[model samples]
Target: MTSKITLFQHGTGAMIVPGLFDGTIDIQELLTHGDTGIGSGDGLDGESIINNGTPLLIRGDGSVTIADDHFTVPFVNAHFAAYSTINNIQINDFQSLGNYIFKHHQYQNILFSVKLHGQFEWVKTRSVFKQSKPYPSLVATAKSEKRFESQHLSGTVIAYYYPDAFSKFAVGGFHAHFISDDQSIGGHLMNFSGFNGDLGIQKFKKLDLELPIDNADYLNHDFKNDDIEAAINQAERES
Candidate 1:
């Protein structure tokens, strides 16, 4: 019998609203949950992409390198299933990609993962600089994010979709990160064009969410008063 596919997520987008940027889970511990995933380093240092169990860190300046196992993350989404390629699609940009997925997959109420590999005419991405003590809200941190764009780039795009109902716990809609084949450019994907690539989709049957029970900031934050949806939209979706 085949094991059920599970999406292992550590921490939630809501934590960002309270400016909880400290690491709650270690990188080594996170890797035990899944092999392929996307996340950001402690204190929002950079974007991370775990390809085939190797975690690559993409810093604010768009530099990519292997992340140390001792490193930790404030947020992550990972899974162990090997992506099953569905088709070779012509992706004009991020919007078109979403439209295609919505029209074809139609799994609006469930969590799913997407992986795209091939050449892109151009790709635009952004990463946040590492924050220090007294971290600011995600909205504030995003204001200083470094943006990078490259032409004729070859790489992999890793993304996850959370239904609107899950917005309180995750960044609803599509949250994607990219890493170049050369491991030189990567970040939170902002925009892209001329994407001729193979698309792979994985639908998950379960979502295993791990909360930071011992984190005082997370436990004491006044989440009820904040408009989390708007904050997430501004920090994550609006580019």
Candidate 2:
């Protein structure tokens, strides 16, 4: 994978301890080193920019607008990971299906590390937006959809906090691998996939992980249940 991705996975607190392919083995040179072009002058990842009072606004095209209050930060210094789950991913304001499957979602115990490499933002209002200072910027997205021996690309997806919004870092270029046991690269290519999450205030504890969602005990607003057999059946059906 590229530095943009490593940076994002880390910024959003994606699972996997820094250089461990799956939190079990050590991968050398943890991150894709060299001018990642992402830094806040103070040395912090995307989170730090927000922590330092940077305001980010989301546009319809998936790009971000750093509020004025935020310093002119190219990127961040400290690198850290976020801890989150699909339970938090939402869409269209209604989250029945999403809430059920992701709440306390399943977890894969493979830790990994992240490091951002070359990064450059471009301003291009001529074609898309109206264009302005620094023009609308575009990050050079990377690709890494090759499947692996353990095709199980599972783990807790980390996220971040915006003053008025709750979201994960988006660059039109975030990726992870899902290699099959036989190590075949059959995943999507240059897949423009982003975590489908929602913005909400913490209700239960700091984290509301749904280890299992039982539909039988489900309430009007709670589908907190698990049906492994049904899930398998559904997967089979879809296949």
Candidate 3:
């Protein structure tokens, strides 16, 4: 199959009402679209990862668990990652690794899927705790975020390189989530070092976005001119 990334709902949509959990799409429906991707569970419970064909949930305490196929998610980005190459490369740190990938990829207006599997000196990650009714906004949740760090471990980093032109609707640059080989720990990647493994690269030429028309929170909410960019940066990146 040709490489394509299907983004279900915009990142901005989640910011409008941070914990909107009444989404219609379930895990079974999601799996039909793609096998490898990342998303969040209902109530922003934890970091959801669809690796191969299994769905795993990474909690705030850095614990891994199997996700129920019937569980719902408000946002998801996935694809049947068909890579062209899985090359071995030496990477010093996170920024250098991104630079190295960019060197091979010259296009600035296209989307790309990436998977790096190997050993690392250190890796830092974060996950969202489940929220209750009358949930807080995304920015507020980011302000008091808790982070987890692992030293000298083997893992895989699943990521996407989204173009800047779609900044408002999605993650502008690289958005990544990580899981260890043991399946004991994982979350949204904040910082990491040493990419000593096979790096899979797949360039995507088409992007299909699915909006939540059945969900009222998504339909009646105001997504225009929101601080989605800032909130995403704050929640997903290191301070």
> Which number leads on lDDT?
1
Best by TM-score: 1
What clash count goes with each model? 0, 44, 0
Candidate with more favorable, higher lDDT: 1 or 2: 1
lDDT of 2 by residue, 22-100 (tens): 1111112212221211222111111111211222322223234442433322222212233222234423211232344
- TM-scores of the candidates are 0.96, 0.19, 0.91
Off by over 4 Å in 1: 1-4
Candidate 1 clashes: the total is 0
lDDT of each prediction vs. the true structure?
Answer: 0.88, 0.21, 0.75
All candidates: CA RMSD (Å) = 1.7, 19.7, 2.2
- Write model 3 residue lDDT over 106-221, tens digit each, in one string: 85678887888899889888887777667778767655556888888999888887787777667778888899999866888888887688888877767777777777776666
What is candidate 1's lDDT per residue for 26-96, written digit by digit as tens?
A: 87888888888999889999999898888989998888889998999998998885677866678999899
Model 1 clash pairs?
Answer: none
* lDDT value, candidate 3, whole model: 0.75
Q: Rank the candidates by TM-score, best first.
A: 1, 3, 2
What value of lDDT does candidate 2 attain over all alpha carbons? 0.21
